[model samples]
Target: MALGGNPIFNGKSFRGATQAPRVPSYPQSQPGYGQPQYGQQQYGQPQYGEPAWSTQQMSSDQLQQMYKMYNRPSAGPAETGRMTFDDVIVKTAACLAVLLIGAAISLFVAPGTSSLLMVVGALGGFVLAMVNTFKKQPSPALILGYAGLEGLFLGGLTRFLDALYPGVGLQAVIGTLAVFGVTLALFKSGKVRATPKAMRFFMIAMLGYLVFAVINMVMVWTGVVNSPFGLGTSVHIFGIPLGVFIGLLAIGLAAFSLVMDFTSIEQGVLQGAPERYSWTAAFGLTVTLVWLYVEIIRLLAILRGDD
Candidate 1:
């Protein structure tokens, strides 16, 4: 739930580098002396109106060196420079790979479905998620650590649920992928957007969801509700388990969270943010997708319970 409807996106502003001073623009033709455009001037060129004797020229090597020094790619990719799509993709892949490995370990090594490991993973993942989220600068190690911890939690939880529901984990995985693919396609096509108004609504709804989640968790912990899912399964709306609706709401929130992530990454790239911030982009996407998967699996579990 940490990534669910986040008020603060890992998409924070990075001020390490600013766009180069637009490679000083020089007029191609001045009113009096027609000095060629900034880089257009060659080794030996006199102003259009200048006398031949007045011409002062430099060597071709000098001109080329000056041009390169002045106009070469000012943005450094390896040096906290502008981010690219490749940076984001590669970083995200690394995080997901770590997550998968962690999941495999938990799934294969856990003894008779241990909730202890799940709890540990959940707690550790939560802590790391908070750390990485709030940090001003993105930390690759911390983000990857969060991924692994989250994966452990996921693997344990999936095993537990699948044991009861049988094949539900696979179903949930498919569902999560479907939602993600659909959301991404819609975003790339510009069919759906996170507008200002939508964002306002999102904030309000997210606040309400957080309140509900906190209350439910408290109810469960305090034993005010005996049900495993607390209020989510205990309460009903329109003869349907309240959790069904709540899970759907959570899924919607997660989907929008993705939209926000995508929008932020788009802005970051367009604004020429540092490539190092790709870790930031990767982190945001991982958070949202994990939330999405959790919601999907939980919803499926709720449905199976109802049946």
Candidate 2:
């Protein structure tokens, strides 16, 4: 059964999925990062006839306090070093600005010859996406490359859709922005979260959706589904294309995916994750927003095609 939508794989890590940088552990008394205080005895060192600090000597309160002090801080807007939601927003906006520039060029200058650009964009984006995802050390060059490729793809796609429905591209853009805004608002308001059960459901649904999409693509490639939209157009319920329903589900999943992204960033900040992990958080968010836009555009196309 289709569960609630989530990321492509929940338990299995993506090859290039960025992770928060690990914070270096330090001794309890150290004032700064990763240095033992001068003349301090190492943990578990034996003292002459004195009681050794051990698990037995620590009270529950002391242990809890220690954990609290050392525990990572939450990812908040104004958190000290951790990546804030504001950082993610800024990066995402920068990406969209690049995308818009590319779209304008494709729409006005190049006109109908966007297929090549789309193919190039998709391939380039995939390569850069993988590089950024798997990179232990984040490179600004690679990250920007990924953004540029994505812009190309977005530009070509927008131009193609605009040619078909005239105003549909704008509509889709508005819808995408609205969804993103609402999702962010909800996240900030604490109305939604990446709870264990919801996350589990999201994982299950994502796997099933991926399998279905793959199968559908294969069928299309093999000429099994004669329709232009593969199984989406041909398979309909009550005169509604299957793709329509699926797209709606996908949009919902994307929204929830944003929530998860927010949660992850939040956790990272709260945990005092290293600052470099901000790039990772940004990448994750960009991936989700791209997915959301794709779904919105596709849905609009399906709707316009029906009419």
Query: Can you tell me which runs of candidate 2 are displaced by over 4 Å?
Result: 1-82
Which candidate comes out best when scored by lDDT? 1
Sliding window of 10 residues with minimal summed lDDT for model 1:
1-10
Per-residue error at 159 for model 1, in Å? Answer: 0.6
**Residue 55 of candidate 2: its Cα lDDT?**
65
Deviation from native of the Cα of residue 81 in model 1, angstroms: 3.4
**Would you estimate the TM-scores of all the predictions?**
0.79, 0.72
| Candidate 1 C-alpha lDDT tens digits along 84-193 | 87888899999999988877777787565556667888999999988888887889999999999988888888889998999999999899889989999999999978
lDDT over C-alpha atoms for residue 194 of model 1: 82
Instruction: Write down the RMSD of all candidates, one decimal each.
Output: 7.6, 11.3
Tens digits of per-residue lDDT for model 2, 267-305: 655555555556666666777878899899888888888
* Residue 174 accuracy (lDDT) in model 1: 93
lDDT of 1 at 153: 88
